[model samples]
Structures are given as C-alpha cells and as structure tokens.
Target chain A: MSALRLIARDLRLAWTGGGLWLPILFFLAVAILYPFAVGPDAKLLRATGGAMLWIAALLAALLPIERLIRPDWESGFLDQLAVRGWADEAVAALKIAAHWLSFGPPLLLATLVGAALFDLDGDMAGTLLGGLAIATPALAALSVTIAALTARAGGGAAGLMLLPLAIPVLIFGAGSLGPNSVGAMPLLAAVSLGLTVLAPFAAGAAMRALRD
Target chain B: MEQRQAEPAPDAVVIDRLACLRGGRLVFERLDWRIARGTLGLLTGPNGAGKSTLLRIIAGLLRPAAGSIMVEGRVALADERRALDPLPTLRQGLRFWAAMDAQPATATDRVLESLGLAPLADVPVRMLSTGQTKRAVVARALQSGADIMLLDEPMNGLDKASAALMAAALAAQVRAGTTLVLASHIPIGIDPTTTLDMAI
Candidate 1:
C-alpha cells in the first residue's frame, strides 16, 4: 500500500512538475530539427530516422536525471522513508517503476510523430517501437541508478556517468530497429531485464552510502 | 493544555559503546545511553560535539563507527532538514507521511493545530517561513506514531511561543507513552528525565 502511494506520489510529482513532458518535447524537437539540419531528402530521412528517434529518446531520458533523486535526498525524504521501515531497495524499485511509467509510454506514443517527421516506413516504425518497449525499462533503470549514485555529488556528473552505462541499451535498442537485425529484440529485452533486476539494489546501496 | 492520564510506555532505546567518525576524525567515542519508556532524554552538546551525528546514528541513518543500538519499537527522526515535499501544501505534504506511516489523514490535523500551522495548512511548503518550516518538521515527527523519536535541534528556528507549543506537544507525547530523545542547544522549557551532555 505504501509502495503504491509512493508510486502515485512520484507520478503526480512528475506530471505536475512537467518532468514527463520535457522528454516528449525534447524528442519532438530532435525529430523536428533533424530535417532542417539534413535537408528534405526523403531517402536520407527514411534511412536514418529510426536511429535518430532512438538517440532522441536516449537524450530525453537524460533530461530528468539531475532532479530524479537528488531533491528527495536533500529534502530528507529518503531518510524518512527508511525510518518508516521501507527498505532502500523497495524505495528505489518503486521510483524506477514510477520513472518508467512516466516516460516510457509517452515516449512510445510520441514515436508516431517521430515516424511522421523521420519518414519511417510502417515496418521500421513498428520495429522501433518494439525495441523501445523492450529497452526503455533498462534506460529508466540506468537513469534511476545513476541518479542515486550521484545524488549527493550534484551537477551534471550523473548525466555524464549515465551516457557510458546506457551505451549498451542504446546499441541494442537502436540496432533492433534495423531490417536485418530483428533478432536483436530478444537480446535487447534480455539486457533490459538484467538492468531492471540490478538497478534497485545498486541504487539502494548508493543511497545507504550517502548517509555517511 | 489538559494533562491526560499517563500510559505506561513500552519502548526503550539503548546505545552502548557508540563511537562516531566524520571526515576521518572520531567525533565521539564510548558513548553510552539508554532511553527507556515514559522518559524524555535531552542530548545536549556544543557545536561540533556530535549532537546531530549521535541522533543520526540512533535513527539508523548513519552507521556508528563501533557500537550496538537496540530499539524496541519504531523509531522516527526529525532533524534540521524538513522531509516534507516542497511542492505540496503543508496539509498535503504532512498527509503523505501520515499515509506512509499508515495513519489516517486526520492525524495531521491535530499536529497542524498543535504547531499553530492550521492557518498555513493550505500554503505550499516552499512558501512557509523558516520558523513555520521548522514547526512543520516537528508536526511531522509528532504525527509519525513512532514509539521512539530522535529529534535533532527540534527548536532551532522557532520563536518563543511556537517553541513552547512544541514543548507542550512533546510533553504530551511522553504522557501518551512515546519515548523521546531531543537534541537541542537551547532550553526547550520541559524538564528531561535524563540529560546527556557532550563536549568537543
């Protein structure tokens, strides 16, 4: 029940704080700007649009990282939760779930615009969406974990640290968008599963360490 | 304020041979204390004397360099930091914790009234003044329903009247069978059953 309340609270905060919209706006901006940069060549746009969308999603995921866990840590929310007999892992897990719920679906939905802008064929768009479905959880996990780790240090350190760690998810997710790389979808899901499983514990340990 | 019949407090918190280290320096060593049921403990110390550190250790937020702490019931801490969300109204922020603590939302009403925050209840927490924010933190600790509360500098930002109200509410909590360990440099106007004074 408490976990549900926390998840609800997180979602509410994300929505009210405009955190959820930032990523979508960023994704759309990237899609919109790409054509201006590369010119209106349909062949070029169709060929690279899916990968650009994937890149946009990855960058958009980074938008929420700095605020994700630091404010809670500074405000002593984490300590209060710990005292309430909520394990750190449980708290981290709930935050990750909330983060995913806030960004993952919206990002998927925004893919329609991405498809239109990028001139992606239906097949490529389907593959891109499928890849994101398998991969966004991993992205959320990575962001949440890095957010916890750099929570006390502050600044853009978390974002810088996150990029390298997220490379595998990006590689697999973007790779799965290729015509011949349909087999990468399962591998992407596998990586996401590993990250989703490991993130809570890693983030929880970092939170505990911050108390010192 | 009416004094209700005192209930027998069932909780006890004991810290033995506790040592704390901060920034590679030992803040304190071999500190021993016990807060038994129905008693108030004042942890008094000068600056840099580890008053807050000891409270954090007791609250299990920080690991003691070497020691054992046995707390028989739920423990809560209200320190210099306000734990409530800044985005929410005072009432909503307090309600979040009350919900987390599995208490009814009405639990916050009594706390709000006690701390004279009833009028400001609808104000966003970020808009609250310093003293009001401090009172809100106290209100949160009071409503926590924890058997043992470790409060660090509980009266830091309060004016005299608000501080007195906080003292009365804390005294009420003790009367209602909650064990309290308050760390404050100023006199809170309530006599503690035991006082642990630390020096640098």
Candidate 2:
C-alpha cells in the first residue's frame, strides 16, 4: 500500500505538470523545422528523417525524467519512502515504470507522426517505432539514476546532466532505421535492453547517497 | 527524581567507545553512555552541544568514526553491508523520521483529518505550529510500532493541550512497554524518570 501510494503520487505529479505539452511541441517543431533548415528536398528529408526523428525522440525521452523526480525530491517524498520499509531499488523501479508509462508510448507515437511527416517509408517506420519501444525503457532507467544522483542539486541541473549522456540512445535509435548492418540495430536494442535492466543498481546507489 | 519504569525492561544501552564526524567535524571521541531501557532519559545541553549527534550515533544512522556501541546487547551501529545479508531480527529497531521539516500549512485537508489531524494536521509539517507537529509526530510514532523511538525535539511545537497529549502518549507507550528515548528543548511530561541533562 505504501509503495503504491508513493508511485501514485509521482504519476499524479507528472500528469499534472503543465510542461508535458512543451516537450511534445518542441519535438514536433524541431522535427519539422530541421528539414526546412537543411533544404526540403524530399530525398534529403527521407535521408535525414531517421536521424531527426531519433534526436527528437531523445529529447522527448530525456525531458520528463527530471520533472518526474523533482517534485518527489522537493516534497521530500523520496527520503520518507526510504524510511518507510522500502528498499531504494524498489522505489527506483517504480519511478522508472511510471516514467515509461507517461513518456515512453506517447513519445513513440509522436515519433510515428514525425516519421510520417518526414516521409519515412513503411519498413523504416516499423524499425523506428520498434527501436523506440525497446529504447524507451532504457531512457527511463537512465533518467532514474541521473535524477536520483543529482536530486540534491535540484531538477533543472539534473536534466542538463542527462542531455550529454543520451548519445548512445540517440545513436541506436537512429541507427535502427539507417542501414541493414546485421549487428547495428540489435546492438542498439540490446544496449537499451541492457540499460533497462542495469539502471536499478545506479538508482539504488543514488538513493543511498541521498540518505547519507 | 526517581527514574520511572514501565515493566521489567533491559538495564542498559552500552556505548563501548564512540566516534563520529558530522559535516567534517569530529563530534565525539570515545564517548560512553549506559542508559537502561524503559527508563526516562534526558540529554540536556546548550546549543551546538553534540546531543543530536549522540542520538544519531546511537541509532546507527551515522557510523562511529571509530570504536563501537552495543544497545541492549547488540551492535546498534553494525555495518550491515559487511556483517550479514539477513539480520537476525529487526523488531528491536524503531526509527521515526520527522516530516522532513516541511511547513505547517497543508495542500490537502483529508490526510490531516484521517490522522485525526483535523484542523492542525492539515498544514504541511514545516508550517505546522510546533505543538501541532508534535502531536502529529507522536501520533505517527504510535502508529509506526517501532520498539525504540528516537525523537528530536518532540515538544518544540505543541500547546498545553497538545503537550499533555504528548505526555499521555509517552506514558501510554511506557505503559504498553515501548522503549521511548526522545530529545526535546521543551518539557512535555511533568516528571521524567531519568533526565540526562546535556546542558552541562
């Protein structure tokens, strides 16, 4: 019951955050504008669409995590949860799951809209969505750790810290669409899968750090 | 004044030798204290005295920089990481943290009333008038069911009525045979069985 209460509180805060629309707008605006800036040749748009979609996807994935964690920290909810018979790992998992639910699927569908706008064909669209589906969990995992680690520093700075670390997700997400190299897409997917599994450790460490 | 006793309780909290560094300052060195369980104890001291520091050290929240402590016959501050994965028993340890110092005003009113908070519990913990927060904390501690209670400034925010309630809770817990150790600037109970004044 206690664990559920903590997670529900986080989900409610995320749902109520007014800025959720801003990221979607930013994603859409960036996706559409980049093509025009680089010259709107259909062929070139097709060529760069995967990369642009992935970049937008990265920002979208990265954006909500800090927001998700900030309210909890500011409210001192995290520390209270820790004291309330909750292992930090369980707490981290709940936050990550909540992050994925709120951001992952919606962001994937948005990517679909962007890909269509960029004129990405059927096969590429499937791969883009597939990669995103696999990658979004990993993104939440990353956010969980970074948010936990930098929670003391406050929210905005934590988001900035995560911006640079998004390189791998960006690489693999876009790489999923570019070419048919046997290992590339799988490796990317595998990394996200791996990160999805591994982030709990980092998140738990962050929880312990905050307690100390 | 004679020390009060609830039941036949443990006779001592033995700190063999204690040490801790808080925020880079060495708060204590080889400090020793032996207080029996179920006995009223007071640690009186002026401001900046290592009173809270001593509580943390005893509670195992802060590791002694050196030496050791055995509370009622167990390593109260044992390093759980190295000692063993499964503790023999955790029932003996009871820790209740404050509302993390939030204000007394409340965003939601229901949580206040449900906890019998009514008008006062509605406020954020920080915004809560001292006595109101005290009542809430004591109410929460009662619900928590921890065997050992470590409270910091339990009476800092209470009125006469609430302070009486605080005294009632402590007496009731002692009646129910719960070990109570609290630190406070203001006195809630008319009589404390054992008062260890840190105000030396």
Candidate 3:
C-alpha cells in the first residue's frame, strides 16, 4: 500500500513538475526542426528520423536527471523513509518505476507525432515503438542510478555522468532499426533487463553513501 | 492516546563506545548511552560537540567512526531539515508520511491539533516561518507512530509558547510509551531520565 502511495506521490510530482511535458516537447522539437535542417526530402527524413528520435529521447531523459533523486535526498525525505524501515532498494525501485511512468508513455505517444513529422511508414514506426518499449526503461534505470550518484554534487555533472552510461541503451536501441532488427530486440531487452536489475541496488547503495 | 495501540515489543536503544568523525577530525569518542522504553533522553552538548552527530548515528543516517548501536522497534528522526515536501500544504505534507507509516488520515489531524498547527494546516510548508516549520516537523515526527524518536535541536526556532506546547506533546508521547532521544542546546522543559553530555 505504501509503495503504491509512494508511486502515486512521485507520479503527481512528476506531472506537476513538468516531467512529462519537457521531454515530449523536446522530442517533438527535434522532429520538427530536423526536416528544415536536412531538407524537405521525405525519403531522407524517413531514413534518419527514427534515429533522430532515439537521440532526442536520450537527451530528453537527461532533462529530469538533476531533480530525479536529489531534492528528496536533500530534503531528508529519503532518510526519513529509511528510518521508517523502507529499504533504500524499495525506494529506488519505486522511483525508477515512477520515473518510467512519467516519461516513457508520453514520449512514446509523442513519437507517433514525431513519426508523422518525419514521414515514417507503418513498419518503421512499429520498430521505433518496440525499441522504445525496451529502451526507455533502461534509460530511466541508468538516469536514476546516475541521479543517485551525483545527487549530492548537484549540477550538470550528472548529465555528463549519464551520457556514457546511456550509450549502450542508445546503441542497441538505435541499432535495432535495421532489417534484421529482430535479432537486436533480445540484445536490447538483455541490456535493459541487466540495468533494471542492477539499478535499484546500485542506486540504493549510492543513497546510503550520501550520508557519509 | 490509547497507549499508542501497544508496541510489538519493549523498546530500547543502546550505544556502546561510540565514536564520530567529521571533516577528518575526531568529533567525539567513547560515548555511551542507553534509553529504554517510555524514557526521555536528553542529549546536551556545546556547539561542535557532536550532539547532532550522535543523533544521526542513532537514527541510522550516519555511520559512526567506531561504535555499536542496538535499537529495538522502528525509529523516526526530526532535525533542522523539515523533511516534509515544501510545495505541499502542511496537512498534505504530513499526510504523505502518515500514509507511508500506514496510519489512518486522522492520525495527521491528531498530530496537528497537538502541535497547535491545525489552524495553519493549509499553509504551504515553504511559506511557513521558521517556528511554524519546526512545529510542522514535530507534527510529522509525532504522526510517524514509531517506537523511538530521535530529535536534533528541535527547539532551535520555536518560541517559548510553542516550545512549551512541543514539550507537552513530547511528554505525552513518553507517557504513551514512545522512547524519545532529543538533542538540544536549549532547555527541553521535560525531565529526562538519562542525559548524555558531550564535550569538544
């Protein structure tokens, strides 16, 4: 019950804090601006637009990184929850789940509009959606871990820290866009699964380390 | 109220040969204390004397340089930071933790009434003055329903009347069998069964 309540609180915070809109707008802006930059050729836009959306999604994930874990940590909310017998891992897991909820769906929905702007056909759009389904959770997990690590340092440092870690998800997710991309799905799921499994523990440990 | 619905077990806090280090300097060493159920512990020390550090260690927020802490039952801490979300109204902020603690919503109302905060319950925490924020933190600690409470410098910004009100509420908690460990430089106005005085 408390876990649900915590997730609800996080979702509300994310919604009201502009967690949803910023990323969607950023994603759409990239799609809208790309056609002008590269030219009005529909075929070229169709070819590269999916990859561009992946990049935009990756950058959009960075927008919430700074506020994701730090405010609660600094405000003592995490410590308060700790003393209440809520394990850091549970808290980390819930925050990751909530982070994904706040960003993942909206970004996916925005991608449909992005697909239209980029003139992607049915097959490419389907592939883009599948890749995002596996990839965004991984992005959220990596961003959250980085958020925990640099929560105390508090600056663009977390953004810098997140870029390298996020590269794997980006590479695999974008790589999956090819003709034999079915093969890339499992590998994409593998990387996402690995990060998802490791993130809670890693982020939990980072939260504990903040006390020292 | 109603003897706090009975704890799962008798509560106790034991710290042995505790030592603390901050900023590469030894803050204190060889500290020892025990607080049993229904007791009020006063942690008194000069500034920079490690009172807050000891409370943090006891609250499990910090690791002691060397020591052992054995605590029975759930613990809650209230320090300089208000912990409650600043964007929410006082009532809303307190309710978040109340829900987290699995307490009914009325638990928050009871705490607010006790802390003289019912009138300002709709005020956003960020807009609250220092004294009001302190009261809000106390309200949160009281609503936690934990077996043990660790309070660090809880009286720092409270006015005399508010301090007296806080003292009364704490005394009531102690009467209801909640073990309290309070660290403060000012007089807490409640009789403490155990006092740990630290020196720099």
Assess candidate 2 and give its TM-score to the true structure.
0.77
lDDT of 2 at A67: 62
User: Across residues B106-141, which tens digit of lDDT does each residue of candidate 2 receive?
Assistant: 312322333345654323344544455445544545
Candidate structures ordered by TM-score, highest first: 1, 3, 2
Q: Residue by residue across A62-173, what tens digits does model 3's lDDT show?
A: 7888788999888888888887778898899999999999999999999999988887899889989989988898888888899999888785788788788878888788
| CAPRI class of candidate 3 | medium
What is candidate 1's lDDT per residue for A156-180, written digit by digit as tens? 6877888898888888888887767
Return the top candidate by TM-score: 1
Q: How far is candidate 3 from the true structure (C-alpha RMSD, Å)?
A: 3.3
Every prediction: chain A TM-score: 0.97, 0.89, 0.97
lDDT of model 2 at position A113: 82
Q: Against the true structure, candidate 1 has what lDDT?
A: 0.88
Pick the winner on lDDT between candidates 2 and 3.
3
RMSD of each: 3.7, 8.4, 3.3
TM-score of chain A of 3: 0.97
* All candidates: DockQ: 0.77, 0.10, 0.76
- lDDT values for all models: 0.88, 0.62, 0.88
lDDT of 2 by residue, A1-212 (tens): 54564465556556667434655677888887887799879998998888887777777766765565555655444544544445778888888887777777678768778888889899888888888888888888888888888777876676677767777777767776777645667888878888878888788877776645
